[model samples]
Target: MENKQRLIGIVLAILGASFWGLGGTVSDYLFRHQNVDINWYVTARLLVSGLILLFIFKLLNPKLTIFSIFHNIQSTIQLFIFSIFGMLLVQYSYMASINYGNAAVATLLQYIAPVYIIIWFVLRKKANFKLFDLIAMLLTISGTFLLLTNGSTHNLVVPSSSVIWGIISGLSLAFYTIYASRLLVKFPAILVVGWAMIISGLLMNFKAPIWQFSITQLNFANVSYLTFGIIFGTAMAFFFFIKSLNYLSAKETTLFGTIEPVMAIVASAFWLKVSFLPYQSLGILLIIILILTLSLKKEQER
Candidate 1:
């Protein structure tokens, strides 16, 4: 039974990675061809996904009302912060990066989340130092540098604003990862994610008003992609992630989740016909190894 559960968890993690990878790729296409503003796209995905999960909450746990969940002032404030910094900031910054840069470049930077997570863990005194952890951190930083430069030290060209936003987005992800994992210990993962999304969606609507666009300007060709992104990419992927967490240890699950960047690279290459330099490919490979090394526990060495 243990082995079976582990296998199931692995499968779910892979599936979640695939969906997220595809979503990243589709996001680029949506922005380029669909005439959708990054803010609007972010808002729509959050609202749609959040509303669906809210419905699920109502259907399955009608006894435990969302209103009741917010009765505690601390929880409410945490939820607000989670929604604002964790979801809104991360997603908006990511989408903005794609708009300012391209999907490949933006995604490569976003993968820096792992490195940030490592830093967060150490700073919070949640984890002690380990030789491999430091090595993994080095690899993560180096890989990000190579990926940023497209494997050429001379070609390291990024706008100042883009660099700031990318790093901010990367750092924000650490908060989201740690907070969500901790909150999962006390609250239903789905409920936390749903509320986070709803709050993020509402906040984004105000920050980047959808009133800027008209229905007539909407790009119909991109609707299908957006629909799939919200339903399968966002909602279903989150569900599978939570499900996998139930079976696997947090570190194990996170290590598997690194598959997202690899999947993104492959998807961008095939679907977008984007090509990377040899060094860039090597950097991406390095990132994969680094994440794998992080996931392997010390006891596994025995």
Candidate 2:
């Protein structure tokens, strides 16, 4: 039973990671070809995915009401902060990066969150910086330089704006990873995420109304990509990732989740015809290894 459960978790993790990776490719397609606005895309994905999650949660737990999170003032404030700074910022920054660059670069850039998290821990005096942490930081810096320069110090291969947005995405992710830990422990992932997403979408609608999109502007292909992003990428990906925690340790889950950037790079190179220099590829490998190392937990830490 234990082995079978672990196998199931592996499957879930793969599915979740692949779905998220492919979503980046879809974002690349939408931003490059379709006349899709980032605001509309973010708002729609959050609202629809959040509503679906709420529906599924209510279906699973008939006695637990979805409105329970709103009853607590502190929880409500936390949800608002999470929705605005964590969820909204993360989504907007990631999409903005993809809009300005290919999915491979944008995805890899966002993976720098682990490095940022380590920095935050060290700064807060919550963790003692060690040799492994030093190695990870060095790799992160060197890899980022190579990724941005693509082996040429003469010029940046990726746009500066894209790199900025990608860095913001990583920063937002790090904040969410640390801040949401307590909330996640206190509440179900679905409940917390559903409310946060819906709230974010609704709040953003005031400035960039999602209801203003014209139906004629959305053809079949455009609609299909958006549907895949919102359904498979946003909703199903979150579900599978959360479910994998039932059988896998946090380290195992993170190690598996690293597949997301690998798949994203592959999809971008093949589907979007993105090419990288030899040094850039080396940088990619180093960063991936760094992420894998980050997943390792020391005996004391664990």
Candidate 3:
């Protein structure tokens, strides 16, 4: 039974990674190949996904109460912020950065999240200040740097604005991880995620004048993108992620998550012709090593 559960956990983790991988590559497709604007794509993500999940909840568990979901207003707000700032902003800003700079640089920069999380923990005094953590942090940063520099230049040449914004994206992710863990301890994870999506969708509607809501302009192509984003990218991936959380240790879960960027690299390489510079490849390798080492150490300590 233990082995069976572990196998299920492994499958869930892979499914989660696969869905995330699909989401990342699909973002490029919607933007470049399909001519779908990022704004529209985000808006569609919120609306379509939220509604679909709501219907699923209604059908599967009719006793579920919307009022019950609202009982933890603070957690709900944090979850919504997770969707808006953590997920939505990251997605939008990432696309913007790539457009402003290039995908290679943008991706390398956005991945600076692990470092930000360390900083976040340090500032909050939640994590022990240890030499290994510091070394791991340095390794993560160096990896990101190597990825960007492609092992070519001693001096990094990233724009200050892109760097700053990328850090903000990482900050948001750090907050999401910390806060989501806190909230999940007290509430149903699905309610937290679903309401968060609804709020995020509403927030996106007001963020810009992107979703025109024109039935006339809607086409099969755009709908196709929308369907893919909501179903495959948002709902299914999130479901598997939550399910995996139920069966795996957090350390095991995150180790498997390394699969996401790997999938990103593979898809980008195959479809987008995005290749790594030697430095960039070295950096990615280092980051993976750091995560593996630190995570394993933590798990053993526990």
Task: Estimate every model's Cα lDDT from 0 to 1.
Answer: 0.77, 0.88, 0.67
lDDT of 1 by residue, 1-302 (tens): 99999999999988887788778778877777776778777888898889888787778787888765588887888888888889888888877877776666676677777677767767779777678678878898787777667666676655545666778888888788777655666688789889899888988888666465677764656668877777887887877876799788877787788777777778878988878777777777887777676666544421
Q: After superposition, how far is residue 70 of candidate 3 from its true place, in Å?
A: 1.8
List runs of model 1 lying over 4 Å from the truth: 1-8, 123-127, 157-162, 209-213, 218-220, 247-252, 298-302
Model 1 error, position 162 (Å): 4.2
Q: lDDT per residue, candidate 2, 1-302, as tens digits?
A: 99999999999998999999999899898888887888888888889989999998999899999998888898889888998999999988999999998888888889989788888889889888888779989999999899889778799988999999999999999888788876887789999998888998898788688898888888999989999988888888988988899999877888899989999999998998889988889889888888777776553441
lDDT, candidate 2, equals: 0.88
Residue-wise lDDT of candidate 3 within 1-302, one digit each (tens)?
A: 98899999999988887777666666766666666666766676766666776676667679767557557678657666677766667656766665444444555455556667767677789777778768877897677667655565666555555556556666666666666776677766666666776777677778654447567646887677566666887787777876797789878887787676667667777878866666667877886677567556752431
TM-score comparison, 1 vs 2, better candidate: 2
Which candidate number has the best TM-score? 2
- Give per-model CA RMSD: 3.0, 1.4, 3.3
- Over 4 Å off, model 2: 299-302
Winning model by lDDT? 2
